[model samples]
Target: MQIKDFMIDQSLKELTEHRTVVLPIACYETTINENIHGYIPLHWHDELQFVLVRKGEASFQINEDKITVREGEGLFINSGCLHMAKDKNNNSGCVYICLNVSPSFVLSQELYTTFVNPYIQATNISYLHLVSKEFWANNILDSIMKVNQLIIENQPYFEIDISIHLTLIWKNLIMNGVQLEHEQKEMLKNKRMKQMLNWLHTHYAEKILLDDIARAGGLSRSECCRYFKRILKKTPLNYLTDYRIQKSLLLLQQPESNVTDVAYQVGFNSTSYFIDKFRKSMNMTPLVYKKYKNSHSPFVNNST
Candidate 1:
């Protein structure tokens, strides 16, 4: 549940620069089990991202759509899309390679205007699942894997090689054509949802009410409930409680922290209520979970 070194502004825009000014691309091999929560929390950035499942299947929530990418398959997420990923099968956590490339890294102005800008700004195309059944999609998957490998190995001229692969992937996307009618309502819902989630993340440690959340999103209580149900499949208060519990996990692992103190710090008015919710969500009491995390080598891979 902890995003290592991950920072987001009040707008819920991720502050991490996955791609640099000089390189404009970066890749990483991520394992779902390594993340304490077995999922990457919802966040977005300006980079167009490609995720290729290397070992297991991953279920992704992009905006309000759920897409599952299996082994050897991939997914393309457009820039500025709200997305998160988790293991589809919890028994074996998903292992995937991610490539984040700047949308503006085009070869020329012509390419940028013709292929990149429109695709990145396409409100209807939040994400596209890539399966091996489609030949072009398979190629894109191969390119994504190759780019990850090239970056990992740091081979000579790997930057050039990676760029070539990315260009090919971009061409495949444009030539194949992904088109859908825009849904302005859904887009606005996504914006309002982000606003509310941002407020929750910022104020989870403070006492909150349903009306407060609604006001933060500039919506009525009913509309706020509907939005949360539509996007997160949970009530506003439920999501807030879940978030508080997630925040408490890291605190619970701290050496000086105790269950009662941690409970109050995370905005739980009653320690018993916190313990009950913790037990239900984690299958253990907060004290037991704390002791276990303390006894074992802590889960240090924080980049959820």
Candidate 2:
């Protein structure tokens, strides 16, 4: 299994905005396929997110818990929660509507504090898994889909409609949630993990060692390795290697860039070793992968 944190001595994010601030609510339709990076690597932001899987299936991981969501179902992830996603069925195409909403948007402070903030920050509720069998879950999924439909259609007053739908979802979550007690140490551990991941992701392209990774997490070298093994099922370096390979996959899509160019760009020194590692991870050579993508690209046929 490939595991990754932000970085050995840096953070992992590659976004211009630290938080979702362009709008109170942002909507996206994510179509999953092999060429487009099948996995949504781990990261967290301050906005509350909901995903409605319209087709196929995906497994959403929130910290240690992993839940598989199928068509017509969905999931709600709280703010600042460490999470990632993967295709539950291998090599299958899945379509989902992703919505990121600021917690305080369109709601009064009292309302948000009571119905939203508690749920987002509560230790008991890292996420709300919405399956068809459950009442509120089904309702939430319907509301999420409706919001996506409005966004794609780009109808007038869509923002107002989206916010209304979101309110319904939020109400359901607040009513159904059960708050649990939290341990101080668990909270501390979470903060440390976020910090370490952030550090590693920022500096992965440079030469770094285990000691640096450990210090990022405020743990000794052995403790750092053990922590990663316990949570991600791989050593720190193993995670770093996978992260490098994953980065290389994106760069290889550009036909102008040769294998050696892409390899050194992602911190690998030896072109031959990079090729060996790339093939081992992807089950194909970089050149072949690039050729495959160019031919099978979905955007090539504009007359569709």
Candidate 3:
């Protein structure tokens, strides 16, 4: 999939490439390259995902940890975990097949209660890295590849075959999954982070303060800064600044939009300050980027 843009909601939930409601499942071959920002930005979705890397390698940042999936390896991401994938070197790209399926599509009441819910609901296990070395993990990877094949082939009763394979994959997980202790504090922090992110996305166009962001997440000022740094690896204000610049990208692409108006529209108090930050982040002036983008120039700025 050559993703140009992602449709994300205020709460950081992904709303794009989600197929029909009836089946609630789809597969696509995704390439991480310069066209789509050279990375998949942080976003969460309600569907469980499996990524099988076919070539090169991709580094994934899931919440607080980072993992690298190489060729012939795969990964399983639990539903609603904040994650992003990119080529760390940024020279060669990574090619992978992704299968996203809603949990409700495969899990019945009994299945949820008995096998699937425990792992998916566990706060400590946001993702499982699958390697060909482990027998169980290899099985899961094979199943993911099989599902991808079924989707591509689209033979009669392919949906049923896909469902059966997915169910068995869950069964393999339940049977061989390692036990993990629950981290209640981590769960609470994740919830708070989501709350803060929602507030930021909802009101990025307006002037914001650190205290206001702390209040939205129900954290003290100091605690808010600490958590933001711990999880996101950036200060709250830094994140806000970057987000403002990201939003300004679309506005600057407009033919009639000027830099000054775009700056103030995205919460920058001064045009000079916005231009400085934009140049720092993008390595080019806003007007220059606008020109290159509008002309469909091959110049690629892979800065995220």
Candidate 4:
């Protein structure tokens, strides 16, 4: 569950250089298990992701919200939004297809006039979380399934056909509940939030207090709390806890580090405390995480 590094310049270059004549959208369907848990721990990419739950249920953590998507439902995670998905069901695991497309692939003048402009104008929500129980969600899911089939089938103009269906899905999403004023205000607030988050990412392993983040954002503690709640829907400390756990994940990946060392490195004082937090946040103990990592790959024994 290592978070993928986001090289902004490289990503933008990739997006811009990618030819539109035949957009190369990566598609994949994978299974989840104890070894290959199918947990994509919190990460962000520049590409928009469309995931359809063909079987089993998935709990998706998008920013601060935890959403459960069951079979017959699908999710559209917009670009730059932190998200992760995992199966919480015990009996049967989940299977899903993921389609990732660079925004530039569909950001043509025509698409702009039709969907992009409207989306930009309507909702400041960086990621669109679609809850599909109704026919609308089903229709979009059906189209996405077909797109995957076509891509796998390697039929002619498959990319174009997928794009067309994707556009329709976008239109339906906009029509459902997206609004302009709310979108604008939310976007402005999110900009400030991102600045705050960047600062935390650079300094989380160090001693950082709520006041420090508040001052960095040019807001008082109370104001910062309200602003954070508005955008991220979580308190500062909660966000910090999740962030710390995420950082610890990388440390856990290393064979040289023990659970206690990982805890102290991530700023937790007590090993017991770290274990408690890691269990609560990740639903697995630190040792289990290490074992999971080792089971999936070649183990290099590094004892401290």
Candidate 5:
């Protein structure tokens, strides 16, 4: 089945509105392409996400670190962590199942209170992205596959079973996932920095200054620079540039769009400068990237 493609805002809204009411879930086996070589672009939400790679390999970036997981391996993402997944191998491909669950649905007092509280409390400590080796019995990957099967089959009380298994999975995660005590303290400061990012995302077309972002994050100019570098490994301005590059990619996907139009829409004031940066980050000119995407996609139509 085709998974629904959602914009960032719509995905966030779905996560919030369905927090405790309905379990937000999806499963798909996707064909990977060789030309698409990079992370899926950083994004985040409130729901917990489980990605199980049944076949092939991919690199997953969680927060600041990158982890590689192969077939029979899986990654668990905690709520609100910025992450991206990509297939790095150009010749081979992978198929995976993605599952998203609202934390509140699993943590509610009505069901599995004993197991849920610890998992919820752990979220406050650090984000998790565990890669395990075993794909068979007593392994997180196996459990995730079982849950996916149950979800697809719509078995009786399957949601309950999935929730229960997820609780156990979280328990294992707490045991195995890395402890980030020092990182957690730094992340507290970084959380404020995210406000600047939000503003940039909302107002990319307008001029943004270092002082402006510092004020938004309630930090001194020097402190803001340090904080962003410490967490994201990039300065605020550099992050903004990367964000613009990503936004330009979405615009380029439209067959009618030209490189100049996409550049301006994504906040670049100079078309030549936009082209330069796009080429640097994407390794192709905007038009070239657009043509490559169109040629690779089977669904694209040449005729309007």
Candidate 6:
């Protein structure tokens, strides 16, 4: 979902919403997929997010891949990637630790130009799963643990320790050749995809077609669908429908809005059709979703 409304931006991200300027890093512990929804809603961020499953099983949607990471495992989401995290079954609470790191805080100019810059300039690797026994994965996880420890202890020069750990993590990834996809063609594709997503997000509440979206991205109709299919594993219309449902969630927050009105405002023509799609996506009716959100009130779920 890429509404980018009041809470999150158009790319469905909360960029610096939870990040600090001085340290440019944050450690978050959260339990998600409990008491309410089955999954964390799809959203992205402007920083690389490292998720470690402390208890229970977790699933992550990184671009086209559906990664199921069990306990003790971790995954690294590239910056500005469209991803979602949630409990696998929604029966048990998925507890996890998330470390958000901004590369600028730790990477030197040389490292950035050679490693981090190339990684950021292109868009092939959506996420790299840190598995046990794997060479680079093991090294990355070790660095993640060190960073977690330093942040939690906050001893003298703890920030410096965290920075060192962060550097180690990137170094491990770069050494494993994760930055080799930074070619000219991928850079152009990434830029065009972002532009297409922006156009779709801005016009989601209006009557728009695939051809219009293709034109906005400067691509042919078939190529436009192919681009989204390759990266997101979904059709253009499917993404648009999901995004409309996401926008409707925010609309349902208003006490005065009814289901039909909310559906119409979010660009759905038929009320019953909207209800069906919303129920299928969110596992509840629009009215019920509104009530649930109100009950949760001021505290935003930090599972993602």
lDDT of each: 0.82, 0.74, 0.84, 0.67, 0.67, 0.76
11 Cα displacement, candidate 1 (Å): 4.8
lDDT of model 2, residue 50: 89
Question: Tens digits of per-residue lDDT for model 5 on 122-217?
Answer: 534434444554322236666777877776787778878877877666666656644433345555654675576676678776778888878887
Q: Model 4 TM-score?
A: 0.72
lDDT of 6 by residue, 131-240 (tens): 86788878877777777777667688887777778888887876767535566786677668777888888889999899988998899999999998987778888989
The lDDT ranking, best first, is 3, 1, 6, 2, 4, 5
Count residue pairs with overlapping backbones in model 2: 16
Could you tell me how far off, in angstroms, the CA of residue 192 lies in candidate 3 after the best superposition? 0.5
> Tens digit of lDDT per residue, candidate 1, span 23-43?
887687788766776477677
**Best candidate, TM-score:** 3
TM-scores for candidates 1 onward, in order: 0.90, 0.85, 0.91, 0.72, 0.78, 0.83
lDDT score, candidate 2, position 167? 82
RMSD of 1: 4.0
RMSD of 6: 5.0
Deviation from native of the Cα of residue 214 in model 3, angstroms: 0.6
- Candidate 5 has an lDDT of 0.67
Candidate 6, residue 87: the lDDT equals: 83
Q: How many residue pairs clash in each candidate?
A: 0, 16, 0, 3, 0, 2
Q: Which wins on TM-score, candidate 4 or candidate 5?
A: 5
Residue-wise C-alpha lDDT for candidate 3, range 1-304, written one tens digit per residue: 3455677898889987666334688777878875335577788998898889998899998887899899999898988899988875676668888888888776777767666666777887799998989888889899989988887787888878888998887877666658965688877888999999999999998989999999999999999999888878899999999888988888987878899999999999999999899899888998898887777635555456
Question: What are the candidates' C-alpha RMSDs?
Answer: 4.0, 4.8, 3.9, 5.4, 4.2, 5.0
User: Which window of ten consecutive residues has the lowest lDDT sum in model 1?
Assistant: 1-10
- Kindly list the per-residue Cα lDDT of model 4 for residues 120-189, writing each as its tens digit: 3334455555556665666667777887787768777777787787677666766666564545555665
Candidate number with the higher TM-score (2 or 5): 2
